[model samples]
Target: MNRKTLVLSAVIGLLAPVLAGCGDSDGGSDGGDAIVVGTTDQYAATKDAPAPLDPAAAYDIGTWNILRQTVQTLMQIPRGGGAPVPEAASKCGFTDRENQSYRCTLREGLQFANGDPITAEDVKYSIQRTQDIKAASGVYALMGNVDALETNGDSEIIFHLKSSDATFPYKLSTPVAGIVSSKLYPKNKVRDGFEIDGSGPYTFKADVKDDTIVQATFTRNPNYKGDRNIQNDKVELRSFKDSDSMGKALDSADIDVMTRAMSPQQVQKMLRSPKDGIQLTELPGLEIRFLGFDTDAPAAKEKAVRQAVAYTIDRGDLISKVYDGMAEPLYSIIPSNVATHTNSFFNKYGDRDLAKAESTLSDASINTPVKLTLHYTSDHYGAGTQKEFETLRDQLNSSGLFDVSIKGEEWKNFRPNQIDGDYEVYGMGWFPDFPDPENYIVPFLDADNTLNSPYTNNTLRGQLIPQSRREADRSAATKTFGKIQDIVADDVPVLPLWQGKTYVASHDDIAGVEWAVNSSAELSLWELRRGSSAPAA
Candidate 1:
């Protein structure tokens, strides 16, 4: 996922490729089906908002889905989940023991879909642009480790890091590392309109209406040279306004696949009463929904106020009311599935102790009923997000400790305002760029952390994070991440909420549905193919 939907997270750990009497794995039936995917996912490129398709500025799951199809990164996670391997690069690895300098050799004869060569210079430019624009989605935050970029002629690119980060390779594998044609994209300014040139698995074309991407079509790139298996010659991704329409489309055979709907109720319903000819497959995911605080905002600026809100939160009641048991209560920023998950908040606050909240404010000499404005996007995370926020507001208000009100807007406008600290406290979600403990903690804790919180701790960022980065074995960094989570609980900059499960609904005839979403939650559109025929409805 890209920023703020950075809209949800990535796909990893896949089910075996669907073996339902499938035929040839690549270019099945000569791409006659043109499988359509439906989602409520939306992004807009306003004058003030970041450019929609530009990899330099775009940083949300919706945008990344398009970029993943059209732009190839140097390194990519294997379809079944393992260490990343080279994509655009013939070979890539850290060149030094310190893990500070990394290098990649461009694959021979690589060319952008539009005919420009994908050179080392293009890799430098694409990564450089993301850092420069620092769009509201904040793709720049992910590249903070790179101190400088160097090119060796046209075939090689070198990255010098500020610290010895073993995870640097994983970062390089994300969509943010997608190599664009340097000749077309500007060095400093964000590219405008709907145009992109890359050497990924597919060439993309989008239909835009009123600055919104109405439909995105992915055609197999004949010029493309990469690691992906092009199973489908063409794929059409259609956007919808809500999950209901998406479901209807799937029912009416309008859409062959549907995902990105944050409706837990719908998930439960589908799982309970299975839909005939429609298979709902669940992917292993690490999507988290948390409340991000604008540390400079009025009441939320106070540590005690933030802590009180944290203490007032009842994750069980909140998840039950909003997610309907589809999501489990999360007590740490890092969910339980990740290594080093600790119930730091639960250990400190004990889940919805009203007296503790009252005492926290009282101890800080603050008055009762701390008024807070909670914010969220209306459409991005499915139709249920509004209800989730409303349920949270009512739950907190019922505690008589917070006079919480909500503000809902579209992703384009909400991201900018949230970045500018427009709301006292805002809702945010994370879909990791890679599979690692660093992916869970660093983005929200580091200087230039993407959450827009001014909160920082030298012990965590300057010491523990960099220390953890040097360890090749992620499990060895447990104690370091444990301390980081403890500091998060103590500071309460973000109120840990619930972790989400990802699901994809598709027609049974789609052979590769199980292999579609990779571990990082990225869509591998090239994997989808139509089998012989759909089962009778």
Candidate 2:
């Protein structure tokens, strides 16, 4: 896949005007004065603030989005889409064909917003801190292959990997690998609170808190050295409790933009009769919602039981009734648009067959009315989640072969419990960190993956993933991916459900809405600007 090419084929209609407006000589001041963006309260910086802005301790997408603006990484995925390019580094690439050794040369005279020198040692320190801190939710897995870190001088750093991984460059592009100042942060401890000193397009200003809600504000970093041009002098990000409230804020012009956490119902309503002054941009679908089975659980331990549950699910009904056609059925972990995706689950299940499900359970000598609980986050996944889970429960219970109970938890509590294996089966959603089939396969199956499930297949985890990663040519790696999907279809550790379309609502005059959502579905706040013709507040 050519990572640098823009992949917004789905929203060309919404993008055309935005892109055209950017070149309009009449458009105001290149949108660098001020802008306000609204986000779901779930993403509010205060809701789950990562104190001290330590890159190693911040793993959540919300925190990473903020960090991406303030911290410079070795490479960065451009606003449209494409290969990871050098950001703070003057240039970076693998030094050995084995893909085991990577090197980077920092731009000369690089300095943080505070004017502190940024050197090769700082890059080495930043990567090492992630491994040393051992935070439960930190992103050490991305750098797990690092066998050694070496610095030749103030400008050059080298990495020796335990294994060859062609995907290392993409990993470095993530905010998780953001470089930090060795002078400011302690070598042995994580800094606490909101203080941040970095060399990026923006600088941390203040995190205003009101009870449980928090809003973060950032100003353009004048001392930064990078390619991104700040479209706004200052950015204020506000979080709302629900989509309805967020829509209201957008319609009323209380906020300039809103991204993520909007339900299909909310988006459809906006599309059908768009409020007079709001514009909605629909992005390509890159997110997947699925049901994960804790293979260690008594009921889920039996492959027959898991297979029965998969067979009983009515994906068509879930898409039509729950998502209202905004989503499509996903039969594999990899989204359909991605290379190597196959309808393995659908090919095996062949539509919901209750009779076949019953036979499968009977053959395994498993009792009927298998009782199980389904867990989901009420707030994090957006509206209709309760209804979505209710529909799922109805489908399984209607089969007469299962008794299902649904449960909902707030994200803060739900995430940890899910990681700790507190539920038998649960609903989970994934947003890709980078656009790669490996991202989908590796995270769910690897021995130390994000999913804390008890499912493990040595062949898929040990051989297929490493083999695929070693193949420089992505097209040649498709066979391995196909085999991995086949194994997932038989194992049924997780049932692939539906992939969703992304939506971003902004005031009618926001010029860069087209560029706001990158290929990975991350919101690029720096791309936003108020059009010259936008009405004054």
Worst 10 residues of 2 by lDDT: 12-21
Off by over 4 Å in 1: 1-32, 532-537
Score candidate 2 by TM-score against the native.
0.91
Give me the displacement of residue 176 in model 1, in angstroms.
Answer: 1.6
CA shift at 191, candidate 1, in angstroms?
0.9
User: lDDT of all predictions, in order shown?
Assistant: 0.78, 0.77
Q: Residue by residue across 430-470, what tens digits does model 1's lDDT show?
A: 88777776887877878776766687778987799888888
Q: Candidate 2, residues 54-153: lDDT per residue as tens digits?
A: 7776665666777888888888876666567888988999988899999999888888998888889889999998888755553677788888999998
Local error of candidate 1 at 120, Å?
A: 1.6
Off by over 4 Å in 2: 1-33, 41-53, 206-213, 532-537
